[model samples]
Target chain A: MKKGTMTLTALLACVTLAGSALAFGLGDAIGGAAKVWEKKDAVVKAGKAIRKGTQDLTPSEEHFIGRSVAATILARYKRLNDPKRTDYVNRVGLYLTRFSDRPETFGGYHFLLLDAPNEVNAFAAPGGFIFVTSGLLAKVKSEEELAAVLAHEIAHVTLRHGLEAIKSSNLTSAFTIIGTEAVKEYSGSQLASLTEAFSGSIDDIVNKMVMSGYSQSQEFDADAEAMAIAFRAGYDPAGLTGFLTSLRDAAKGAPDTGFFKTHPPAGERLTKATSVAKQKKLTGAAAPARDKRFGGYKL
Target chain B: MNKSFWTVCGALLATAAVAWAASTVTVSVKQTSVRSDRQFFAPTVATAKYQDKLAVSGQKGDWYEVTVNGKKGYVHASAVGGGAGKKEGSSIFDDDSKEPGKEDVALAGKGFNPQVEKEYKSKNPKLDFAAVDAMEKITVSDAALATFASQGNLSPKGGN
Candidate 1:
């Protein structure tokens, strides 16, 4: 009777150990497999979804955003607060706007001449607003050069640069709203100051928010667009290079301030523009003289 | 156990962490007082034109270059104290960070006045803001020197 009892105990112990080993091993293996599979599935699904969404943005959507942003910019620059010279600006701006790829009516581009004559500058806001400062005009030699500058700004708009800038940034909703509101609410001086100080040491933050400029690729693209527009409108492509070179030379003497610091060096810009003109096979076309309609305003 | 856990944790944080943003540099006016007392060496009658050159670049004294008419001349360093390179408040704009709408241009008027509107009108009081709006229509050639070689306005012989 004692021998039978001992044998029974040993058999039970062996059975318990084997059962536990099988259960733990199988359970862990299955769990680990499931976790990895889930991660892989998620990644594939996410990538496909992203591809689908990008495909959804049609060219019309691009144009729609482009027009709204441009109109808001033009309205802001109008400084409707100053009514005395509005017609003169409006007429010239309207003429230029008429020449753009998108007519001014599609969110017509307007020009604003700031009263500061000593400080020279101009810009093209996305959509169709072009701003030229009296200060900047004082520096220009003629209508064609002026037109070349305007055409460059116009290309930035037609190419949807501003909207593209916003879309590419990884901004939080709050900052984005602030930027949008700032664009609409800030007056020119405010905008100017905001932009002026943007180039300070905190470069890392500014690049993320405003995207200070187009990619080297975008700059090239805009140059092509500007040249095409100018060439078609009877303006010479070489004028763009000449204007860029002259600005480069003048920059040496001008107070080391503002736009020149932000823009590409004059030499690099001229080289690229000239190369493009050559590639397009455009030759010896003459642009207008500085003294014609534009000569009277020089200091 | 310890090494694997730390490695996994690091990978998770790295994947989840937010990316960095772009930044700008702040260039301030070095002082509140313009260096007005400074003097220029005028060999003869102190001509106002040619002043940007006379202000020796590294001189410790404050030298102001003033433009009268089309000519640029040097000013009494003391009178210039209100304006030249004085340290104003620090402001920032982006240099080269890759985000969107990042091109913020800070326009500093003749002085550091924050309001470009008032500054605009004050500078050109003769023309109302609207008439001056036509100024944007002016070309670089219209304002600066032009290469008239392309345009018929200058005979090939007459242009510089």
Candidate 2:
């Protein structure tokens, strides 16, 4: 109860401070301040929304945040050294991005193969720093299936799922710090606070990507978008269904650990994804060439 | 006071609002290519960076057709935000949204940039950023990508 009032007070303060920034419009007053003030009532509501953490981070910011998360994940896992496999995975991942809504990310999309031969999962750090484990790669039986998995990871990135994991309080504090006008450089105190918030944000995202997993709804959304992207990219939508079917079989009686532990039951995911495929009429046949390449790149 | 006068006033305000919604856009990405065409594989005509405001003359799909330094090109909509702000490289501000606080990272270069990363890295030496750098280095060239697509019998036309 005490925390609730404190939050409200802090939020009100955020609104107040944000309003003051409008006075000078932060050194670059290209947009008319007069026009801005004319809609002060609406602006305040927007400020309230921002103060409540309903804000979007720029692509550059997401890139920086993603790098740290990628670094953290790297600290926990080892990268695969097979240049052939790594190059092959990157080629597939990058090709998929050209067909995603957010094809062009601030730092561009990069795919890293993690040498987790026993861990069947993938991680899409905010921007496009995506990591796919070797065990998961072993599960894929075709180029279309591989594309299906990558399309899902790319969907996660394009959807900004990791940022959704950031705590709103941390975002509010960061907004307060950077949304100031005389902010050429972070003062020592400001830097400390901002760093603390930034560090916390990273922790939040990494926790979601690792250890625990995104909510079931998030997973389903990714699956839906993945199928859409796969269909648009000229791959058989059955690729997603096939991949999900494989997981459902592999996960039967599997211990509640690793991928199976963090994600929804593959059975449930497959059901919903198949339904979506039917609705979208997502029909296509795997090209013989694609199957051949998949056989060649088989790890 | 009269109906025609009120109509004229309303028309002017509506025109102003439309102009305001699509005038100036600030760069949101660290850097984005202003391409000859609205596709990633298109040739880059100009380069814009974080906080650099560009004139958003028009929009094509998700790509914003912008002119910076009189050179016309296209920037992805995700690479920019805000409106009605003139930027000469150094200026960074957001007055685009009628709602205050719509743009949070205009001070991004000063915000969570490399400097912050350096600080964070120093504090967290246990993190393996070297591996991250190695992962980042795994890039696909246009030639390699084209070949991969061709070999796979895939023809990716692009998306949102």
- For model 1, the stretches where C-alpha displacement exceeds 4 angstroms are A1-93, A96-99, A167-211, A253-256, A284-291, A296-299, B1-160
| True lDDT of residue B49, candidate 2 | 76
Model 2 chain A: which ten-residue window has the lowest total lDDT?
A22-31
Model 1 lDDT per residue over A196-273, tens place: 322121132223213354566666676676766666555555667777778888888777444564466667777888
Best by TM-score: 2
- Let me know the DockQ for model 1: 0.02
Question: What lDDT is obtained when candidate 1 is compared to the true structure?
Answer: 0.40
- What does candidate 2's lDDT look like per residue over A66-126, in tens digits? 9999999899988888898888888888988877777666678899889999989999998
RMSD of 2: 11.3
Candidate 1 fraction of reference contacts recovered: 0.02
DockQ of each: 0.02, 0.29
